[model samples]
Target: MANDTGREAVKTVPETAGEDQQVQERIRKQIASELNLPQAKVKTTVTLLDEGNTIPFIARYRKEMTGELDENELRSIEERLQYLRSLEDRKKEVLRLIDEQGKLTADLKASIEKAGKLQEVEDLYRPYRQKRKTRASVAKERGLEPLAGWILSQPRRGSVLEEAAKYVNAAKEVPTAEDAVQGAMDILAESIADDPKVRAWVRRHTQDHGIVVTAAKNKEQESVYEMYYEYSEPVKRLPPHRTLAINRGEREDVLKVNLDVPADKIHEFIARQYIRGDSAAKETLQAVIADAYKRLIAPAVEREVRGLLTEQAEEHAIRIFAENLRNLLLQPPVKGKVALGVDPAYRTGCKLAVVDETGKLLEIAVTYPTPPNNKVAEAKAKFRQLIDKYRVELIVIGNGTASRETEQFVADLLKELGRPELQYIIVSEAGASVYSASKLAQGEFPDLDVAERSAISIARRMQDPLAELVKIDPKSIGVGQYQHDVTQKRLEESLGAVVESAVNHVGVDLNTASPSLLGYVAGVNGTIAKNIVAYREENGKFTDRKQLLKVPRLGAKAYEQCVGFLRISGGKNPLDGTPIHPESYGVVDSLFQELRLEREQLGTAQLKARLQEQQPEELAPQLGVGVPTLRDILDSLQRPGRDPREELPPPIFRTDVLKLEDLAPGMELHGTVRNVIDFGAFVDIGIKNDGLVHISQLSDRYVKHPMDVVSVGDTVTVWVLGVDEKKGRVSLTMKKP
Candidate 1:
């Protein structure tokens, strides 16, 4: 394996070409090109991280070395490397299995060596591979394979039954030739099943054209699985929701599900592969394979194809969920105002809390604004007194238990007071209960009840989503689809990336950011996060981002990635409060120099206008940076001291609450979609049970997936299709009635 210079040689290592080794090699070459190394020098043995390359580091610092490989491409390279290595290990294991069976023929060995993909290699290894006791073994035990073949030959118009009967002697323990041929047919069935080419072909055909057919095992069986009692659809075309539902139905034993490929098509395909044209033996061979299809191969292949489809759907769901969660979490915060929080309930009344501009609790109370349970007039009075007493400018309502009724009650009070300036939001209270029971919640609110603590947290969430939301686990936020099913580590990694991206996108205010939010910033982990909080306690508020450099272990690289996303409001320099990374300060300065403008002289509104007028070609050359980067810097300089997440969108405020019975099919109604997985979108539609819009029912055009059209927080227009009050399930569709 040594090369001309004594290094490892670049070996082609012939593989069974399933997807294409060239695609993989192209990716490797791309990686090598990015690293500024020859393809030969970058061996497969090298680890990306051990070679001093981080994802961000390789993406940002080694741009010239990576041929400007972006984050997405780098991640793809990392994934493909793992898959290729796994394929190699699998190949070795397969070869070992065949060799140990002592059936490794020269032809078989040649086929395996020449194979360019895993599928092909596995195919060639199939016949010789060890397996459990089968019908083929029993036929061999009876010593009747040749007899079966002779009957198949039908010599001189002989009767097959008579010929088979002669072979079935008392010594063999077969009662008759019919029985002997049955055993022979079993052997042929096993042979057909073991054929690698047939297996590979069947797999491809099933994936490409198979349909999932479901039927009620017993039509009279009464259970919660009525909708899917008898349902069937093409595998590729089945929506994510129905797939999950059908799977659940099968698990619960109410339905029988099978992968349905046209039997005729498979028979024809197999006939082409195994049977010769117009021969006497052809009929016998066809009969054996037909028996195999019914008794052996069909079930096995069906299971394999079904499993593959499920895996593909699950992966698609995980990807969509991650993206939707990112957007929802990164939404702009409505900051710098006192907020009144309300945790709405009917039996206990609405629990309320008032927090100061910085989200420190100032008061708590229980109030009822409208009801047959409590006097509407009295409840309204109590609520008004609290709002006036606390001077609350905004209200935060938890979108939970009686939220719409409470919003209406509060809206009525606001209208009576003539305060149009006051606004309220219905925030998702996903992990509020979990947080309420946690040690952190207890430590923060030792004197307040759990409900009151929840109310206070809701208020703070509006003030700073990044800080407040980080206290709860990302998975608990309810924005993900099949969040529980994905590989736990991958889920956590993807969700963590989303949180970090969101936090960084809307830069944290260093002076006010909590340890949880700080920990997510680039280069700041839990220990450093705690240290920053401690340092701030000892040294007062941070006036500028430069003060971060003095914090222990806060290095230049970390500072560079994080500073732009960490803002300082009311600072001397306006740029400190914007997403203009400190490393690009020189570029901003040069832009100002060309315009004869001083740093302090720039105002956000005018500066943005001016930058737009000054072409990228005119400004980028002067700054000595790429036009893309220069344009971004100019845009940031214009809005020097701005909070990226300005105001949270107004939460759904309804005048009245309606039950599921109140909704009619074809009624156009507004509702929030709580979760979106691979198959379909789940819309709350203000009902007790959320209704599913199967992926097929999602749009007018062909939708490859539900995620392409909708996301978790999206407020959608849905037409109520049907309602099952007993099951507490509503059926809604995005399509117009």
Candidate 2:
């Protein structure tokens, strides 16, 4: 490898080759077993990841090396690899800590080495961990450890009281035989609690059989969590959404939560383990076992169970959020259409923005079409003038305050204009306000108010959801299930990964992409993204992928990671617009030469048919490329500059709006799914409230989860199941009524 200054840098393999090889093998085996993939594939993927290859890059460009593993599989392998490495590091630290204390037994060391999770390793090290003074430590200091050990042995010949009498020493705070017995019991209790196997058994038992019970702190107070006020469910069967809701309710002091474990069953299990003989010490030992459970083990185990539940819940929530964000971002963009965006308001006025086909702002206005002012005639006239002036083909109304009224107004206005081509869509305004108040939005529209900027954002989002939505924080997009309840750092990481995967999957236009969009490319960070944009401003639009090398802070590795995901049309090379990496250009050139086809015919149907006729295995060796790489190159050539999202169903645009009062039982209507949750999906049916389609109502057969049948941006036809005008709720069903 050569450095940036063009000097050859010496690369030396590490001297710890044997250890490195062993670690690599272990990681490969573990990942292969966990992901149910072949060992060779896991090995190659791990090697690439260890070599600092990005997930998207490895998945897209190194297909043969990884046996054609996709991004999701690679990401899973990457995440598990990091976790296992951390686990190994913790294991080493634990062994060293135990050795320093002269307590590293062979069995203990073996157990630590075999531990799969950090929690298990920590459990093994609990006895060796340094501690603050507790009843057990204090009792040990009083020299009652020997008595405790004798009690643990369950001596048949010795009387428990007589044994306890020997430890009574006033100088060490053991004044009476009873006091000495209590101290010995305390020591025994702590020992039982500290035993790794004992703790593990108890934790497993509680988690498998415990019931999570909740009660309302103030039942009369009306809140969204009323359904959970008297909730009780088995810990093992608790759903992630319920867990999050219970946690939030508890946090708000609106509910009292408890883990109810069977004490008698736990006592029986402990007694069976320790109380072996019918000696006087048996009763003492039994009493101590109960103390161990009630005083120490139960509390610790309860906390562990709760933590496990929360962790599982958070993982599920994050997964749902990532899935929703992916679907939402990948929604088909309404391209090549002039759009008019409306940010609806009541007392103020509806803010409007008109953008050309390329999302360039052409006009901005505020009209009093709703509420107090109610200048319907004047507002319609102004909107008509803007529509005629910009030749607006579509209208995007933000689904916020007064949204339904504004939609009705627009529907009426479109009818008055007598233009059948003009249609309107109620786009989700989630995070639009946040984007408007952001520094990026200020830079883009310094003269506009927050509402006006929001209107423009709405317009552009319809034009290209991925490009416009990337500007706002993903969590603010409102496509998640209890997103705020999860760990923010974890949620951010998962959502960021989702965004990056989606952005890379649908390659970005190098010339037109915003810094926010480019920042999500495989290896491009915010600074490098900004540098690229600045470079474009200072120089000119990137004519070739190689121009990325000249951008500040964008080194060879970063370019290697991001180049394939950034496309340029009419650039130096015809393959620049496709997903063909620069490193594979040689093979592509060979392919083109062998086929006797010009670069300009890359995306033609004839070229696709010709390429389809050639077998990859036969042509790969001649082109000096792997079969997988050759196949990918052929596919890219067949569909140059293809947007993967263009295949999804387009957003439903409405020519007329329906009011809540107009909905009747068994009335069939088309709706756009707004959000999918565990139990149901919320669908926008052109009303004030999005109707709910319960999991049971999603299909004729049983539906395990709403996401199984619907996603965030899916368009589905449904029939009204019921309606409550007083509470503003609409119940809809997808199954046959």
- Please give, for residues 449-521, the per-residue lDDT of candidate 2 as tens digits: 8999999999999999999999999999999989999999889878888888889999999998888898888
CA lDDT, every model vs. true structure: 0.71, 0.89
User: Which residues of candidate 2, in runs, are more than 4 Å off?
Assistant: 1-20
How does model 1 fare in lDDT? Answer: 0.71
lDDT for each residue of candidate 1 in 359-455, tens digit (9 for 90 to 100): 8888888876535466578877777787788787888888888877787676677778888777666677878777777777887788878898889
Give per-residue lDDT, candidate 1, residue 145. 88
Candidate 1 off by > 4 Å: 1-24, 29-85, 92-188, 217-224, 277-284, 368-382, 439-449, 480-494, 522-564, 568-577, 582-614, 618-623, 641-644, 647-737
Candidate 1 lDDT for residue 241: 51
